[model samples]
Every structure is written in C-alpha cells, then in structure tokens.
Target: MQAQARGRKARRWIIFGTIAFGAVFLVVGLVLAGQSVSLLNDAERARGTVVGLEWRKDHSSSSRRNRSDDRPAAYPVVEFTPAEGTPTRFRSSTGANPPSYEVGERVEVLYHADSPEDAQINGFASLWLLPLVFGGLGLLTSGIATVVALVTRRRSRPRRSLRTTGP
Candidate 1:
C-alpha cells in the first residue's frame, strides 16, 4: 500500500512537472514568434557588407574540457547605411566555424527605423527557428503527458460488476 501511494505521488509530480515545463516552452515560443513578426513588420530593409569577423575564445564549461577549445569562433561583422543616416556597423547574432561570410560579401539585412544599429540578417534560420522549435517541442510534450495521465487513470479505476436477476 505504501509503495502504491508512492507511485501515485510520483505520477502526480510527473504530471505537474510536465505541465510546467510545457507551459514555459509555449510561452517563450509565443513571445519569440511575436517578436519575430514585429521585427519583420517594423524593420527597414537594407543591403549590408560583411566588413569583418568578430572572434571570441570559448572558456565555458563544455569548451573547458577540450584542449583545442582555445581557438576562437567567428561571428560576422556587417556594415550598412540606413536612409537619412551614416553607415552603421553591427555584428551578427549567429556565428559559425570557418566563417559564414567573407569580408566583402553583400547580404540583405533588416534594421529598426529609429535605431539602425539594431539589425539582423533577414533569413529563416536566424529569425523563425527558435520559435518554431520551442513551440513544436512544447506541444509534443504536453500531448504525451496528457495521454499518459489519462491512460494511467483509466487503468487504475475499479471495474463495475454487473448483477442480473432471473425470474
């Protein structure tokens, strides 16, 4: 009986945790998606040139274990001229090894009308990837949790006995 009680308690905790985790992901996904839409609508389009690469050495937990981690990862540095303003320079949020773009490459960018320095490379991977991934994972986890809870509850219920009287 004690073991059964513990099992039930564990199940309840699991359900609660699953719900909380799912809710967090869903909320973050929604917020990120909204921001992406707002950026798309409000930002102005401009042509930018890759002026350089911003390199930084990794010293974080995962990188600490490897000896070769001392090498720097490079993020693109882009420069663009907004209308009614001088040329502004900004580094990209996304980075890759071997450098994603060359110093002379021209790329499409979106910048705020007021703050042109706040810019992003207009692309699906950079813009909408996070929101889609988080939203999808949240829906999947919530659905699985709901199904498990329902199935467990159904199996734990006592079956009724049918009584028949014959004349």
Candidate 2:
C-alpha cells in the first residue's frame, strides 16, 4: 500500500514537472513571437541583393551531422539601400547547409530607417522559425503530460472481481 502510494506520488510529480517545462517553453515562444511582430512593425522594407555568403563551421547543437563530418553553413551577405540612407551591407544571422540564397539574387529586406546596419531578411524562416520550434516543443511536452495523467488515472481505478459458487 505504501509503495503504491509512493508510485502515485512519483507519477504526480512527473506530470507536474512536464507541465512546468512545457509552460516555460510556451512562454519563451510567445515572447519571441511578440519581439518579431514588434520588429516587423518598426521596420521599413527595401529591396536587397545577396552580395555573398559567409561560411562558418557548424558548431550548433541543432546540427544533424556526425562528429566526423565538419561542413560549414552558409549565411547570406545582403546589400540594400534604405529609404533615407546610402547602401548598407549586412550578413544574415541564420545559416543553412545547402545555402538558402545565391549571390546576386534579389530579396526583400526589413530594417529600421535610422539603423540600416541592423536588418533582417523578410522571410518565414528568418522571422518565425524559433517561435514555431519552441511552440511545437511546448505542445509536444504538454501532450505527453496529458497522456501520462490519463493513464495514471485509469490505472488507479479499482477493478471488479467475479466469484462463482458450485453445488
């Protein structure tokens, strides 16, 4: 009886822990989403060209390659003319394995009119990737917690016994 009670407590702790973890992720995702929206609202759009690619060694934990494979990711260097400033060149913070853009390719850029040096490529991956990834993780963990809670509840229910008498 004591062991059963301990198991139930452990399961409850697990459920609570998972829920807390998921909530943290959800909050982070929401904060990032809000920042992205604010940036877009304050930014001015301009036409830009991929001037070059800056290749850097892939040291991020998200990299999918084995330790032996050491391939560098390519981040685009863009040059654009802001509404009130001369042409400015800035490298994108996001990088891809196969290179997302080619040199001389035209693309949409978003930047503050006052600070053309701080700009970003106006695209789904550039702006929304982090929020989506974090939000997905939060939902996944929350779903797991729900499933565990349901299973624990079902298992805790008492079962009925059948008896037969023969003459």
Question: Which model scores highest in lDDT?
Answer: 2
User: Which pairs of residues collide in candidate 2?
Assistant: none
Model 1: residues with Cα > 4 Å off, grouped in runs: 57-59, 62-64, 67-73, 162-165
lDDT of 1 by residue, 1-167 (tens): 99998999899899979977887898889999999899999889999999999997656777574776456778889999999679999988877677778999999989887888889988776688889999888878887888888888898889888989899
RMSD in Å for model 2: 4.0
Model 1 RMSD vs true structure: 2.7
Q: How many backbone clashes does candidate 1 have?
A: 0
Cα lDDT computed for each candidate against the true fold = 0.85, 0.89
Best by TM-score: 1
Worst 10 residues of 1 by lDDT: 62-71
Model 2 gets an lDDT of 0.89
Model 2's TM-score against the true structure: 0.82
Q: Can you give the TM-score per candidate against the true fold? A: 0.83, 0.82
